[model samples]
Target: MEAEIRFGDFVREVSLRQTHISFNELAAYPKLDNKIVPINRQNEKLKVSLKDIYRILGPYTTVRFVDQVKAVIPLAIYLMFFQIFILRQGIADAALICGGLLSVMVGLMLFMEGLKLGLMPFGETIGNTLPVKSPLVVVLGISFLLGVGVTFAEPAIGALKAAGQIVSVEKAPYLYAMLNEYSGALVLMVGAGVGLAAILGTLRFVYDWSLKPLIYLSLIPVLLLTGYVGIFDPELAKIIGVAWDCGAVTTGPVTVPLVLSLGIGVASVVGRGDSSLSGFG
Candidate 1:
């Protein structure tokens, strides 16, 4: 605690970059089980009073806020500078834009916090527990449903549904229709694809299968469909963009950590061979 408090961000940055090291390899490795009291700093109790809430939250809040600020502010500043210098365009309603950016930063932080505290742990717990208790078929069925569920829950999909306004119907009828009338169907299909991918990913990890063949197999149909659409059905070619976006968002916040946790949990239980990490081949 004392070491962390002194160096703060420097300590954290160094810790984040540190690779996995065995305890035996670490310097000053403690063998004794008994607790050692530090003379330099007073020990804090596990329990905290209501008055201590601000103190407890202070460092965590700062770290989270700074993290979000790093993610959002730099790109925003670069874009604003580019607009001013390169484009020679003044930023209209700069205050409103700043407020919106701040809101986005706060929202992202809360979203991440929610994923860590509620969603991720829930997924990991299920992943860790299910393989031990349930049958293999049940675990897979759960994975499929989880993929579907996360797709439906993804905030980006809802935003994607509203992205049709910029797309001209005459130029891209199928794409326009898919985003509007057939949006639900499109989303369902994306969800199904993600669910299937999750199952395959889990199996790949456990069976120590090559990812290259899967990639080749997957790309075959996509390339064929894309080529067919681009050549024969020019009207549907515009939808390739939408299709790409759909594929992209299935890997969004709601789907990734949760599904990955579930898959990893299954793998840890049912995995074969001595492979810790699978190579590209």
Candidate 2:
């Protein structure tokens, strides 16, 4: 607080210092509240007049003519190669070319749409739901079943089928059926096992366990099995190797995108997006 006292023409003043400002003092101060100016909603004023619009659009008409001239180079090149020199004539070739391109485009569209709507969400639901299922055995069993079923439908199996056709029918016709079936079953088993592994990984993440030990332990079995396969059954060895390779490759096109997204989504929920367990194994 400050005070001033005056007697006749002489005066004396006293003042008090403050360390902090008070809200009450601030509240007493008057403030200006200016009203906002309104804006016009109607866009009646045309900045660019009709005359200017015509002038600006004039150059654009010439661009189409220039574009046609630019296209003549490729047209001339095509005429020289296929039409003049090679002399491959007919409407059939044109139809075939157009059809092939259109087919590829359609296939890609369907694949993308299917993955987005069906496979991805489905797999994610399975991953998330399975973790909370009734009993331990049931959850594990369901996970295994899902792994096998999904892997069966994977596009990479087409490669396996083709390879089986090549080796079994050509190299060893006698063991064709057995080899093919065994190859498929073994591959399916591994895929299911992989799925189970991923689930267990989710559990470990929930418990805040490190992943390195599990990864190293997994590698041990893979090495030992591969070694054993190489020694005893050479034909079976090739089949198993191809199956495992196909297990990876088969998660292709539709399956890969859907399954991977699903895996990530489920793992995210289970692990609460733990950094160590986010990626595909």
Candidate 3:
């Protein structure tokens, strides 16, 4: 007999090699008897100690925390030096800045860990399972929705919106309106574009289409639109930079892993291995 035990993200299989042994005989085995008795009693107690919890989670938390520190520390140091030395001005409120930076570091650590341990797995699982279990339309629908959801959820989108807050309305009323008043609609438009891109990208994976042609086709429309906006709507033309920035920011930390995981999972399942771009799709 074999038993599979799952502990958080870890799994272990235990096999009873001496299946024929009776309860009395099992008790006679010194190492097995010693370990199994305590484990069985512990299970019966049904009590979890903080130490045990820490043992299970400590390494994962420590590694993720360290990774975030390594990522954020350099930026923090650079900013501190630039503010104190180059600018010759101390931080406005040292305590507040420290608290805020600590909070950000912790939040980023948790978020990154969650992405690695949860979201990426979920995305890959859905991508791998959908094509096999659901209809093609359903898979495409899910992909489109995922794309839209990830784009809207991205942190970089908020930064783009923030950039709009300082834009002088008098200088570019239309741009300001789109960024502030019609921001929801603007986000929807960008999300829709991303969703469509995801749909086409998935289709390309399924049918083994060349990415080169798609790139050319997309560029033509983008160039023509840029020219049209530049020529016709000068007020709205001010937003051309922001509009292009939206595309870049759409593929942020949250979106890229989720979308890439989904794309790679689907491609691995349905695609021909011969294609040079099988997983790249």
Candidate 4:
């Protein structure tokens, strides 16, 4: 019986050797004991398992989302409370309280995820695809279109328009209509200006231009315009400043990431060339 057991063990070992698995292939599998651990930047050792690898990045993969929920849930809770208690609002029935809150949370997460995957990629694609034509008009037009399209969907403009109605009414009820009109016009101007800025920024990126000189150049024109407006009407000067300030605000959550990425990508491409900075300096 002992001789037979020894022979069986020898056969098992020989058979396993014949199968022949590689280190990389073994590492790719999920068995815990097979993993090689590495210490990270924080001096912490991390675990690796085939199951963990699949969980992290297989079909239907998901992110570990503590920070994501922590950030958004409180605000969602506040909105819920405001709707239920302060505003005395409710669905036609009682069940919608849960449904509404769920909808808001899901909607917000989907939107954020879409921005990360969709908008950011699109912006980078556009930056890479900019034309190499010499006259510059074609590139400017493309950038402007991108800016305008993105800005119209921005949250800031709508928020400002709503806020304007509230504040303007308190100051002068009769001027409410005028305020609304002005607010609308202001949003339009801002959207257009951002579009132009994107175009100019793209051009600078193609040229490999430095930011400081471009900023100074832009400032000179803006200062000159402000001075020109001030001489005509002091009140208008204040109004213009407020409107311009509001422009930056209007580029809220939706516009900033897209534009900033687009700007950086364009700058990178321009930097590779020998000419002036292509996009934003």
Query: In terms of lDDT, which candidate is strongest?
Result: 3
What is each predicted model's overall lDDT from 0 to 1? 0.75, 0.58, 0.78, 0.63
lDDT of each residue in 26-68, candidate 4, tens digit only: 3433333335644333432454678656644442222213334
lDDT of 2 by residue, 168-210 (tens): 4565543465447576665666577656765665556456556
lDDT of 1 at 21: 39
Q: Which portions of model 1 show Cα errors greater than 4 Å?
A: 1-53, 273-281
Q: Number of the top candidate by TM-score? A: 1
Per-residue CA lDDT of model 3 for 94-209, tens digit only, reads 89988888888899988887897799778877877899998889988988898889888999989888878998999999888988998888888888888898899788878878
Give the C-alpha miss distance for residue 231 in model 4, angstroms.
Answer: 12
RMSD of 4: 17.2
Angstrom error at residue 236, model 4: 3.9
TM-scores of the models, in the order given:
0.77, 0.52, 0.75, 0.56
Candidate 3: where are CA atoms >4 Å away?
1-56, 84-88, 231-233, 274-281
Lowest-sum lDDT 10-residue window in model 3: 11-20
Q: In candidate 1, where is summed lDDT lowest over 10 consecutive residues?
A: 272-281
Shift in Å, residue 188, candidate 4:
1.9
Predicted candidate 1 versus true structure: per-residue lDDT over 1-281, tens digit per residue: 12112367467545442234343433333344446743444434355455455555655676777899999988998999999999999999999999999999999999998997799768867876887888767877887888888999998899999897667887778888888888889989998988788778766765678778999999899999998988997777778888888988877888887876675556555655432232112
